[model samples]
Target: MRVVMSVQIKKNASIFEMTREATPKEIDDCKLVYCGHGFFDEADIQNNINKNLMD
Candidate 1:
């Protein structure tokens, strides 16, 4: 999955102004992630998104 977002700086803070899913082509070309010693998958991504949204 990919996300298109607009960030803003206000009072020395960064705020996410907008966010949307990115296209397959965009994800393929621009996706960047460093799993390091951890395992990552679609379920991990979905879980993280859900957790953040709840907070």
Candidate 2:
């Protein structure tokens, strides 16, 4: 089996933090902000292509 991961970012006032799962609307908002620019999805992670964003 393979492990899949997701990321959620939250902002309060002027501070931004990585928290937990967000609502569908939040995800949609992110999609708009980060339209392109080579973002990875669940399938990309599973296939082991460009998986390391920190690299």
Candidate 3:
């Protein structure tokens, strides 16, 4: 599965974002903030969106 990884490129800048493979744990944790294409939503991509949102 895949989902959008909304990460901030800078201060209040969320334009620069990407998609990534959605892990079961991620879904259970409600970490999928946004949704995107699977073409770029590779599992290899590191997802730090949830962490950033907490900050």
Candidate 3, residues 1-55, lDDT tens digits: the string is 4354554455643533445455678757854444344432564332444454556
TM-score of every model?
A: 0.28, 0.27, 0.27
Clashing pairs in 3: none
Per residue, candidate 2 scores C-alpha lDDT tens digits across 2-44 of 2224435433211112233445786587542221223345564
Q: What's the C-alpha lDDT at position 49 in model 2? A: 31
Q: Which 10-residue window of candidate 1 scores lowest in summed lDDT?
A: 32-41
Best by lDDT: 3
Q: Which residues of candidate 2, in runs, are more than 4 Å off?
A: 1-17, 32-55
The CA lDDT at 25 in model 3 is: 84
The collision pairs in model 2 are none
Compute the lDDT for candidate 1: 0.43
* Root-mean-square deviation (CA) per prediction: 10.8, 11.1, 10.0
